[model samples]
Target: MNALLVITALLAATPITLEETRTQGRKNTQALQAELDVTVAREDQRSARSNLLPQVQLSAGPNLSYQGRRRQVVTIPVTETEVLTREVVSSANTSDSYGASLGLSQVIYNRGLWKQLEQAGVNVDAVRNQSIEEADTSELEAIRRFFTLFLSQATLDVLQATAKRSEEQLERARALFHAGRVGKTEEISAEVNLGNDRINVVQRQSQLVADQVQLAVWLARPGTEALQAVDPGILQQEPAPAPALDDALKQAREHRALLRALQQRVRVAELQRAIVRGDYLPRVGLQAQYAHGNQDLGPFFSEPGFGNTFNGGVTLTWDLFNGFNTDAQSARAQANIRRAELTFAQTARELEAEVRRAHQALDGQIASAKLATTNRAAATQGLMLAEERFRAGAGSTLEVRDAQLKLTQAELVLLQSRIDVEIARYALYRATGTLNPGDSQ
Candidate 1:
C-alpha cells in the first residue's frame, strides 16, 4: 500500500500536456456542472415519458368501529290464532375491518401528455447541446491559461539570458574604467542596466509562479506543486490560414452548439404552445381497481369470510370553462414562441459577427508575427555589429547598450507575436464553435 501511494503521488506531480490539462479541467470544473444539468434534463424526459404508461398503486389498512344499541318493534303469531307485539334490541361494542386495494390508471388519449413528452425530448436535446458548448468553452479557457504560463516561462528565459550578457558587459566596462580607457559613467551605466535586468528577472519569476498556481487550480491540483506544460505543437507550426468570412459564417450557423441549442429551444416553445392548446380538447383515460376486506383480521382472504370488489371504467374529462385560464396560457405560450424565434435570430447574427472579428484578428496577428520575425533578425545583426565595433573601440558604450536593448525588445515582441497568432487561431476556432480538446494543436 505504501509503495502504491508513493507511485500515485509521483504520478500526480508529473508534468502534463495541454490536451491532458484540458481533459482534467473538464472533469473538475464548470464542464462537470453542465454534464450534471444534462443528466437532470434526461431524468425530466424520463418522467414525462412515464406519464404515457399505466400508473399503479397498492394500499392496505385496518379499521375499528363501535355501534350504539337500537330498539325495534316486531309482530309475532302466538298460540296458533293470536298475534302479539314484541320488542327486539341489537348492539355492537366494536368491529374490526381489514382492507386492501390495488388500482391502475392508463391514459388512452391525452394530447397534452403526448405533446409534453415531445417537449421533454426537445428539452433534452437542448440541454445536451448546451453542455457541448460548455465543454468547448472550458477547453478554450484551459488553452489560454496554458499558453499564458508558457509565455511567462519564455519571458523569464529571455530575462535570464539578458542578465548574463549585462553582467559580462559590466565586467568589461569596469576593466576599461580601471585602465582609464573609459569614464566612470560608462561602468555605472552598465551596472545600472545589470541591476534592472536582475529586477526584471525577479518580476518575471513571480509572474511565472502566479501563472503556475492559477493553472493548478484550474486542473484541480495542489496549487503549491510546480506544474509544467508540454508544448502541444501549437507554437512550432505556422498558423493556419483563416477561412473566408462567408465560409466561416456558414460553419457557425451549422456547427455552433449554442445556435443548435437555441434552435431546439424554438422547437420546444412550439411544442409547449401545442401542449397548452391541447387543454381545449377532452381527455380520455382507463382505470381499474380491485379491493378485498374482512371484518376480522383472521382468514381475511377466505372465500366465506372475506368481501371482494372489482371495478373498471373508461373516463372522459372536459373543461367547459375555467375563467379564461386556458386562453391566457395559450397566449403566453405564443409569446414565448415568438421570443425564442427572435433570440435565435439575434444569436445567429452575433455569432456571425464574432466569426468575422476572430478571422480579422487572426489575419492581423499573422502579419504582426511575420513583421516581428523580420525585426528580430535585423536587431540581431545590428547587435552583432554594435558589439564588434565596441570591442574594436570604434563605437561608444551607449551604442552597444542601445543595440542590446533593441535586440531584447525585438526578441520579446517576436515571442509575443507568435503567442498572439496561436491565440487568435484558437479564438477563430471558438467563434466557429469548433474548439475541442482534440484540437489542442
Candidate 2:
C-alpha cells in the first residue's frame, strides 16, 4: 500500500495534457450537478406516467371502543292481556374490533392527466439535452484553461532564455572593461539590459504561478500544489485550413445540444397548453374495494364472528364551473409556449453570430502564425549577424542589445501566435458544437 501511494502521488505530480484535463473536467461539480438534474427529471416523468396506471392500497388497524348507555326503552306483556313499557338506564361495556381494507383505482379517461404525462416525457428529453450541453461546455472550458497555463509556461521559458543571454553579454562586457579594451559606457549598458531582463523574468514567473492555480482549480485539485501542462506541439506543424463560415453555421444548427434542448422545451410548452385545455373536459375512472372486520364484547384479540364487504363502481366527474382558474392556467400556458418559441429563435441568431465570429478568428490567427514564423526566422538571422559583428569589433554594444531584444520579442510572438491558432480552432469547434476533447480532429 505504501508503494502504491507513492506511485499515485508521482502520477498526480506529472504534467497533465489537454485530454487528461477534459477527462477530469467531466467529473467536476458542474457536470455532476447537471447529471443529477437529469435523474430528477426522469423520476418526474415516471411519476406522471403513474397517473394513468392502476393504484392499489391496503389499510389495517385494531379498533377499541367503550360506550355508557344513558337510557333504554323496554316493552313487556303483563298478565297475557296487557302490555307495559318503561324507560331505564343501561350498563356500560367495552368492545374491540379489527378491520382491514384493500382498494384499487384506475383512471378510465382523463385528458388532462394524459397530456401531463406527455409533457413530462418531453421535459425529460429537454433535461437530458441540457445535461449534454453542460458536459460539452465543461470540456471546452477545460481546454481553455489548459491552453492558458501552457501559454504562461511558454512565455516564462522565453523570458528566462533572454535573461540568460543578457547575463552572458554582461560578462563579456565586464571582461573587456577589465582588460581596458572597452569603456565604462559599454559595461554599464550591458548591466542595465541584464537587470531589466531579470525583472521581466521575475514578473513572468509570478504570472505563471497564478496561471497554475487557475488550472488546478478547474481540474478540481488542491490549489496549494502547482500544475503544469504538457506541450501539445501544435507549433511544429503548419496551421490547418479554416472551414467556410456557412458550413460552420450549418453544423451549429444541426448538432448544438442547447438548440435541441430548447426545441424540446417548446414542445413541452405546447403540451402544457394542451393539458390546460383538457381541464375543461369530463373525467372517468373505476374503483373497487374490499373490507373485512370482526367485533367482540370480550377481551382484545378474542375470537369473534366476522363480516366481509365488497364494493366496485365506475365514476365520472365534470366541473360545471371553476372560478376561472382553468382560463387563467390556459393563458399562462400559452404565454409559456410563445416565450419558448421566441427564446429558441433568439438563440439561433446568437449561435449563428458566434459561429461566424469563431471562424473569422481562426482565419486571422492562422495568418498571424504564418507571419510570425517568417519574422522569427528573420530575427534569428539578424541576431546571428549582430553577434558575429560584435565579436569582430564591427558592432556597437547598443546594436547587439537591440538585435537581442528583437529576437526575444520575435520568439515570444511566434509562440503566442501559434497558441492562438490552436485556441481559435478550438473556439470554432465549440461554436459548431462538435468539440470532443480527445478527438484528433
Candidate 3:
C-alpha cells in the first residue's frame, strides 16, 4: 500500500507510479471473474446428474363415448297357472362409456443412465479445474496491466523533472540578464526550451493517465487523472522465488485445467462406448396397473354393470439391431476418445514449453532487477557529487544537470526492472500451475 497524500505531506512526498494505483482494481475484478467461471462449470456437472434420477409426473383427463348393440346372457322365468302356461325371454340394446388416470415411471434398469451419471460427475470436477486456469490467466493479465501503467508513470516523472529543471534555468538566465551578465537572446532561448519541456511533460502525464485507465477498467473502478502518493515502496516490492524448469513443467501437468478437461473428455467417450455396447444386452423392468369400466348386457339380458381389472408384468427391451447405430456410435466414441488422448498429449507439450520459458524469464528478470538497483545507487551518488562541485564553482551547471538526469533515468529503469521481475514471477507461477484462486479476499 502507498500512503495517501495530504497537502502538507505532498511537500515531503516521494512520488509513486500509476501502476501501483491500478493494480488493486484489476486484482479485485480478477476474483469476481474467477468465481463466475467456476460456478458456471460446476452447474454443467449438476445438470448431467439430473438425468439419472427417477421421474414422476401428475396427469388428469376425462373421456366419453357412445355405442350400439351391447349384449349379455340372461336368466328366464318359467311358471304355470289355471288355464294358463307362460315362458319368458329377455333381449336389449344400448351404449355409453367414460374414464381417466395418472401415471408414473421409474428407471428400473438402463445401462446408459448410470454410466452417463458417472461421466457427469467427472465432467463437473473438470470444470472446477478449468476455473482455476481462468483465474491464473486473469492474474497474469492484471500483472501486465499494472506494470505497463507503472512504465508510463515512470516516463512521465522523468519528463516532469526535466521541465522543472528547465523552468529554473530559465529563471536564472533571466536574472542574469537583469544583472547584465547574459544577453537578452540567451534568456529568450531558455524561455523557448522551457516551453518545449512543459509540453513534453504534459504529453507524458497524459500517457500515464491513459495507461492507468487501461488497468483500472478491468477492476471496474473510476480513473485517476494523475497518480499521487507520499511513498514509493509499492513500486519496489518483489515477488517470491521461482522454481526450477523441470519442477514447473511437472507441476503444470498436474494442475493445468486444459489437461484435466481433455482427460475428462476422454473418460466421457469411454462411457459412451460402454453405453453403446449395453444396447446388445437387455433392460428389464416391473409394472402394475388397475382399471375400471361399465359393461352392459342387452340382447338376452338387459343391464348396466361395472368391474375392476388388474394387470402385472415384467417388461424387457432390447434393440435387436438398430441399423448398426450401436456399432457406428461405438466407433465414433472410440475415435473421440483417441482424439481426446491426442489433444491432451499436444496440450501437455505446449504447457511444458511455456513453463520452461517462464522459468527462464523469471531467472533473467531477477538478475536484471539486481543490476538496476546497483546502477541507480551509483547514479544517485554521482548526482550528489556533481551538485557539490557546482556549489564550489568547480563544475558547470550542465554537468550538474546531466548527473540529475542520469539519476532520474536510473530510478525509472530500476522501477521498471522491479516490475519486470514481478511480472515474470507471476508468469512462472501461472505456467507452473500454482496460481491460487480467491485473491480478491
Candidate 4:
C-alpha cells in the first residue's frame, strides 16, 4: 500500500501545465550552452575594459658573486722624499645581494585599444541576444510537446468513448436478431464496428504512450510510462481573432532577438574597422618606476652597498608602417561590416514574410474551428434522431451505424480544428518573436 501511494504521488507530481513544462524545458542543453556563451563574452568585455586602467608590477630577487685570489701593487712614502713599491695579496671572497623594483604604467592615449574595448562590449550584447533567442526556441518546443501530448490524450479518449458505444450497439443488435426482429447480418455488422473501434483505441493508446515518452525525455524523467496529460479545456473556448499584419510586422521588427543580435554584430564590425584604422595614429603613455637594492662595492663588502633609484617618464609609440598589414586589416573589417549589414537586411525581410504567413494560417484555422463546431452540433443531433428511430423499429441498424460514424468523424474533426487554431496562434507569436511559455493557454 505504501509503495502504491508513493507511485501515485510521483505520478501526480509530473508536470502537465504549459508553464511547468517551460520551466523544465529551459534547462535544455542548447539554452544552457547559450547562457554559458553569454557569460564568457561578459568576461571578455571585462578584460578589455580593464586594459584602460593603470598596470602595476613588482619584482624582487637575490644575486650571488665570487672573486678569485689575485696580486696587487702598493706604493709607500719613505723619509718624506723617496717612495717604495711593495707587493700585496688579495684573498678570495663571496658576496650576496638582493633588489626589488616596483613599476606603474598608464595609457594616456590609445585609440586602437579604446575601439577594441567598444567592440568587446558590443560582442557581449550580441551573445546576450543569442541567449534570449535560444531560450525562446526552447520554450516554443516545450509548448509543442505539451500540445502534442494533449492531443494524443484527447484522441484516445474519443476512441474509448466510441468503443463503449459500439459495444452497446453490438449487444442490442444480437438481442434483436435472436428475437427475429433483425437478421444475423445486422449482428455481424455491429460486431465488426465494435472490433474496428477497439482496434482504433489500441492504436491511439500506443500513440499516446509514444507522446508521453517524448514529453518525459524533455522533462529529463527516468520513467516514460504512466504519464498522463490533463486537458486544459482550451478547445471548448471560442477562437480569438487574428492579429493585424501591420502590428505583427512591427513587433517582429522591434522584438526579435535574432535580428537584434545581427544588428549588434554590424556595430561590432564597424568598431573593428575603427580599431584597425586607429593603428595609424601614435600611442602615448606615462610610466614610473622605483627600485631599492644592496650590493658590496668589493667582493668582501668593503664599502657602503645600499642604493635606491626612482624614475618617471612619458612614452610614445608610432607604427609608421608594417608591410601594409594595417591597411589589409582595415579592408577586411570594412568587408565584414558590409556583410553584417546585408545579413540584417535579408533577415528582416524574411521575418516580415514569416509573420504574414503565420497570420494567414491563424486566420484559416480559426475559420476551420468555427466550421467544425457547427458540424459537430449537427452530427450530435443526427445521432440522437437515428437512435430514437431505431428504438421505435422505424429505422434499420445500418442507419444507426452510419449516424454513429458521422458523429465520431465530426467530433474528431472538431478536436483537430481546435488544436490547429491554438497551434497556429502560437506559431504566429513565434514568428513575431512574442512567443513565451505564459501564452501557452
Instruction: List TM-scores for all candidates, in order.
Output: 0.89, 0.90, 0.73, 0.85
Estimate the overall C-alpha local distance difference test score of candidate 2: 0.84
Clash counts for the predictions, in order? 0, 0, 3, 0
Per-candidate RMSD, Å = 5.4, 4.9, 8.1, 5.4
Q: lDDT by residue for model 1 over 1-441, one digit each (tens)?
A: 322432353356547787787678666568889999999999999999999999999999999888888897989988788989999997657888999999999999999999999999999999988988888887777778888887876777677778878888888888878888778988898899988888887787678778888888877788887676665675566667777888878767767889989999999999998998898999999999999988877768565435989999999999989899999999999999999999999998888889999999999999998898889899999988987886666766688789889989998998888888887888888888777634321
Question: Which model, 3 or 4, shows the larger TM-score?
Answer: 4
Q: Model 4: what TM-score?
A: 0.85
- The residue-by-residue lDDT of candidate 2 on 66-176, one tens digit each, is 999779899888978898999989999888877878999999999999999998988988898888778877877878888888888788778778877888888888887
Rank order (by lDDT, best first) = 2, 1, 4, 3
Could you tell me which residue pairs clash in candidate 2? none
Which segments of candidate 2 are over 4 A away from where they belong?
A: 1-13, 68-87, 297-306, 437-441
Rank list by TM-score: 2, 1, 4, 3
TM for candidate 3 is: 0.73
Q: lDDT scores for all predictions?
A: 0.83, 0.84, 0.65, 0.82
RMSD (Cα, Å) of model 3:
8.1
Residue pairs with backbone atoms closer than 3 Å in model 3 (clashes): 91-299, 92-298, 92-299
Model 2 alpha-carbon miss at residue 96, Å: 1.3
Q: Which parts of model 4 are misplaced by more than 4 Å?
A: 1-15, 64-95, 220-227, 295-305, 394-396, 436-441
For model 1, the local distance difference test gives: 0.83
Question: Top lDDT: which candidate number?
Answer: 2
lDDT of 2 at 38: 91
